[model samples]
Target: MGKRKRNERIGALIKILSHQPNTVFTLNYFSEAFEAAKSSISEDIVIAKKMLEELHLGTIETIAGAAGGVKYVPLVTPERAGFFLEKVCKKLEDPQRIMPGGFIYMTDIISSPSMVETMGEILASQFLNQEIDYVITMETKGIPIALMTAKALNVPLVIVRKNSKVTEGSTVSINYLSGSSNRIQTMSLSRRALKEGAKVLIVDDFMKAGGTAKGMMDLINEFKGEVQGIGVLIATREPEDKVVEHYTPLLYLEEVDVKNRRIIIAPNPKITTKI
Candidate 1:
């Protein structure tokens, strides 16, 4: 193979760092990839880290000692996160999303692994400093993103279920007003699912009335656990005039005129929601 140029080395380093965000890299690892001496790769890393910091995209962390390695940490600026989410929101406007009552059916986005992974990381970044002992979500559609967010935060995932089975062992259940419908619905959790006072980060795939999210919050409180943050992949405009207290969303679909084959996709304002 031809000897790679300096720019090639830099690009490769950046690419690796981007994929494994917040992961440490050893000088030896870079030396092996570039087939260059440790000193040469070290010089390259210094320049690469500087460039990434200059762009305000990532953090290059240095470590000392035998087990020490460099890590690239992604900091998604609000502007960049807004741009990414706006594009994603536009994808939901497909005429095929027209379901009953003019509801935009977005099962695909919720179930997609790539989209879930990206959205999960963005939310995780925001709560990186919090005491996120666990990630919580309700069953059915919210499981994937909850699991992914849990993986990102390296925390346990607690799932709230619609009904409990004897096979599920002991569980704690609670009731709350559903945001989707003004009626009350009950949600359950397996006993011992979360340690007492654990700081839980609540996540869900979609939000309309936020009834389910609120239900999960009530359930978490029943366990005597603390909720550190709340996240949703998509937040739909409430058909009913109502609002929830605290939450963050990647994107918002303000309008979907499937009748006219038009749609409005926007970056959700950084939610002033925290609990």
Candidate 2:
């Protein structure tokens, strides 16, 4: 590869490393892909690490022993996360996003893959050590984020359905009020989906009245599973009593000025200590 092309490859690799910390790669892996020597790749890695640390993005950790490799660890400082969310909140600016019931409609944010992945990564970073066995979400919309979080944590996912399935031999069912509507709804789980004492994290696309969230908690309790934590993509902040006390939200929409096409969202509130 020419000098310019080699430098570009190095830069692209650095960007990939930024997101995948703790992932190790062999020198042969890069050497074969870039047609570069191990010595040159090592130098590139050193320079990239310096650039990353100087920019305060993350740290490049290098292991030098027999199984040595490189890894990037992103320490999303408080300022960084807050700033990122602030910009993300601006994307929700739509006059039609405001519902008649004084709620900010944020289905768009939940449906966007980039937004959902970012929210999942941020939440997963916070629970790096809670020994999360699997991620749990109520069926439908929450599936994407729940699946993303599960992938980030390298765990399985279990979706609670509103109805039973004929394919599953037996099922566990629990009743809880749906968040959108105050009426009670049944959530079902397959008999083999989760095991007792498994630490499960509950995540949803949005949090309004939180009835669905509470119902999820009840279903989890029924399965003999432990609720590790709860999280949501967007939350309505006017009435603090609307959602559970011990939960995390990626964005807090305090107000939605439909007439002005303005929607305000603040940084997600982090849980000081897991519940």
- Which runs of model 2 end up more than 4 angstroms from their true locations? 1-75, 256-263, 269-275
lDDT of 2 by residue, 23-95 (tens): 6777666776777788888888888888777875756777788888777655445555666676677767556
What is the Å distance of residue 21 in model 1 from its true position?
A: 6.0
Task: List, in order, the clash count of every candidate structure.
Answer: 1, 0
**Per-residue lDDT tens digits of candidate 1, residues 57-125?**
756777889889887766555666666676676687667778767677777887889887767777877
**In lDDT terms, how accurate is model 1?**
0.77
Q: List the residue pairs that clash in candidate 2.
A: none
After best superposition, candidate 1 residue 196: deviation in angstroms? 0.5
TM-score for model 2? 0.73
Cα misplacement distance, residue 143 of candidate 2 (Å)? 2.2
Clashes, model 1: 1
Query: What overall lDDT, based on C-alpha atoms, would model 2 receive against the true structure?
Result: 0.75
